[model samples]
Target: MYQRLITSRHFVPLLAGFGAMLCITALSSLGSAVQSSVWLMAPFGATMVILFGLPESPLAQPRNIIVGHLLTTAIGLSVATLVGVTPWTLGLAVGLAVSLMMLTNTTHPPAGANPLVVMLAGEHWDFLLMPVAAGAILIVVFGVLYHRVISGKQYPKRWF
Candidate 1:
């Protein structure tokens, strides 16, 4: 199963993009919410952009980033609101968000920690929309530009 999954064309792009983004995230010191949020760093956005944005992947496109992060944030905030922040509760929140993201078909694995981060930090719910979702969108946009410049890969096949 692992081999089969990794052999897909999407795999290489995902890995490459992730590596590039990780490098950028580490070297650059951007103060954006996305940068501030540990959960929204390079590997996460890189994977989403490569896997979903490139070749116009339905799952990796900008919409997916926006929608997926939004959904995950909601799940996390909801869990946090319902139950105060505790180790067990935070774990449950993260697990539930992951399950929900999969069920909803917006499975952005890196986003799995969003709920726990928000819950533990006791941050406002709006943080998801800002640095998280917006950060993701920015990453996808950057990826699109980067791929086009470096490799001539068309992104978002069709802009909505």
Candidate 2:
């Protein structure tokens, strides 16, 4: 029974969930003692799902996750500061982010929401550095370590 359970198709998925839990818990705890820091945002939950559960996917690549989040957030912040967040601007921001992500070859879908997050949350320029850049960097680092140490697999199939 134990061997069968270990070899079951669902075993890997269970492991992935466990991995995601650990990574998020670590990220959350590292935030302010009050756990109110932007260190863990909404999109990060989806990011974790991909990072831990589908590390082999191109969208889960470190470059994609980091660059995609940074680019979209920058675009959103710029638009929000300059034009403002009307329905049109919101669509414009997301469209531009998608197009640019495709062009840059860094299309992490979860990051597709960063623009909306920024616009709605009224995040300032500092947001790009804190939760956007810093958080993405830490997530990628932790994913690398987790996959290498726990899964015995190299994450990011390709660094480029």
Candidate 3:
């Protein structure tokens, strides 16, 4: 997975998408839905653009980005709700999210933070569906438009 993820075809678009997302987020002042103050969510959006939108590498394919993030959000939110908001709960939420994502075969690394963000923020749990899940969907939509329609790249090679 690491070898495939780091290849030139994957890395170049990943970086470009990351930069693009950052610029859009900054300009729009959406204030980053991710819990970490750092621009960590950028990579999640970037990965979607590279894999789902441009899809030069197998790992970057749309299935990996969309299914991966959906699984991550579901597991993360479920764990957060079950465990409640505490230090250990937060840890468990993130851990469960990661583990579930990996198990589900949709492992988008950056989404590991979603559970933690929901737990720490003490959100109403609906946050997972909105802003977090919604944001990801928006990112995917933007990537499709930018990489496919505009840039002439094929996105969502196969919709499962």
Candidate 4:
């Protein structure tokens, strides 16, 4: 049974977990060097799962990951700045983010937490550029490389 599990592709998830570990570690290292870069965001863990564990999903696409994080974070920053971080505004931000993601055809579920993260932290505009935009972009890039080199799989069925 143990040998069957090992050789029957049951360890793919474990392999993906290792990939996640490497990716996040690289991000964290860069984030430490770059003061403005916050590559270790909460939602990124979920992003890693989709990227490494299920890279074939549409949500794992580069466009989806980048645009979803950017759009959601923008909405969060806007709502937090203009409407404040009250309960209703928080809901409003997340709703708008989801709706906009659907409208833009970039529906990455993990990015949905951007509003809460932004509102709760009261992040400035730089947050959109650093962790939201840049971190997401690098994550996608890492996912692509990991899939090709380590997992021997195709990723991102589409680019746009």
Candidate 5:
């Protein structure tokens, strides 16, 4: 099973990575042009890796990517606001995000960093919307379109 998984044609990941990076770059440019407060967040880099490089992962699915980031971002922002951004609070936020994500069945691993991002940046509620939620949704949109245009691969094996 492992060998079969590893033996994919080399170009698959390469092409996917290129396309994903292009999409992300475009998103960043758009965000800059619009002068949005928070256009891109750090975690979305990992998101690109999953969405493009490992499109087969359940974490890469539209539902998981969108919900996981949104849910975790909300939890992280809440924790930061409620508990304040101390060492203990940061730890608590990440733990809560992970646990909540697992319980919700929306476990996108990249989202695990959301708490740290929020706490470290000292961000508030708005952080949940722009860079976290909006960015994630855009990535999903790009993934869906990219897969449609690219032949021989079906993205978002399932929607919800």
Candidate 6:
């Protein structure tokens, strides 16, 4: 079963995605180092999967990536700040984030986790800047550059 899961066809895409994540994480590390701050977050791993493994997916598009993250982060921060990080509040925040993303047409599956991250960490507004906004933008920009220069796949099927 394990052998069947790993195939020759999966090698390059897997490698490419892995490499892209490495580059992205490394850049995040560099940003953290230079600024002496936390620039990495958990949700970005899922973002990388969508951006690199499913570049042609609608979720991988620039608009979805950026707006989805921004919206979800805003919701997460708002809920966390206003309601406090109770179990019920976290649930409500996640539900609201998902609903808002859908309503705004900025649905991104990875971003669904942002509410949990923010609430759990008790993060304030700056949480949106470093890991949410900066990380999402980096992933988009990296995916575009990596696919265009190295992988030769269209990074974004559409910008909007």
The best candidate in terms of lDDT: 4
Candidate 2, residue 53: how far the Cα is off, in Å: 1.2
How do the residues 1-160 of candidate 3 rate in per-residue lDDT, one tens digit apiece?
A: 7445544586756656664655456424554544532322444654544454345554455556666666666666676667666778777777877787777776666666666655565656565555556556666666566655444556656544
Off by over 4 Å in 6: 1-8
- Candidate with the larger lDDT of 5 and 6: 5
lDDT of 2 by residue, 63-158 (tens): 999998999999999889999999999999999999999999999999899999999988899999987898899999989998888765579798
RMSD versus native structure for model 4:
2.9
Q: List the residue pairs that clash in candidate 3.
A: 51-60
The digit string of per-residue lDDT tens for model 4 on 12-80 reads 888789999999999999988988557778999999888888888999999999999999999999999
TM-score: model 4 vs. ground truth:
0.92
lDDT of candidate 6 at residue 159, scale 0 to 100: 84
lDDT of each: 0.63, 0.87, 0.58, 0.89, 0.83, 0.80
- What is the RMSD of candidate 6? 4.5
Quote the lDDT for 45 in model 3: 51
TM-score of decoy 5 = 0.90
Give the per-residue lDDT of model 6 (tens digit) for 94-130.
9999999899888999889988888888888887887
Error of 4 at 45 (Å): 0.8
TM-score of decoy 6: 0.87
RMSD of each: 6.7, 2.3, 7.2, 2.9, 4.0, 4.5
Best by the TM-score measure: 4
TM for every model, in the order presented, reads 0.64, 0.91, 0.62, 0.92, 0.90, 0.87
Give the range where candidate 2 is weakest over 10 consecutive residues by summed lDDT. Answer: 1-10
Q: How are the candidates ranked when ordered by lDDT, highest leading?
A: 4, 2, 5, 6, 1, 3
How many residue pairs clash per model?
A: 3, 0, 1, 0, 0, 0
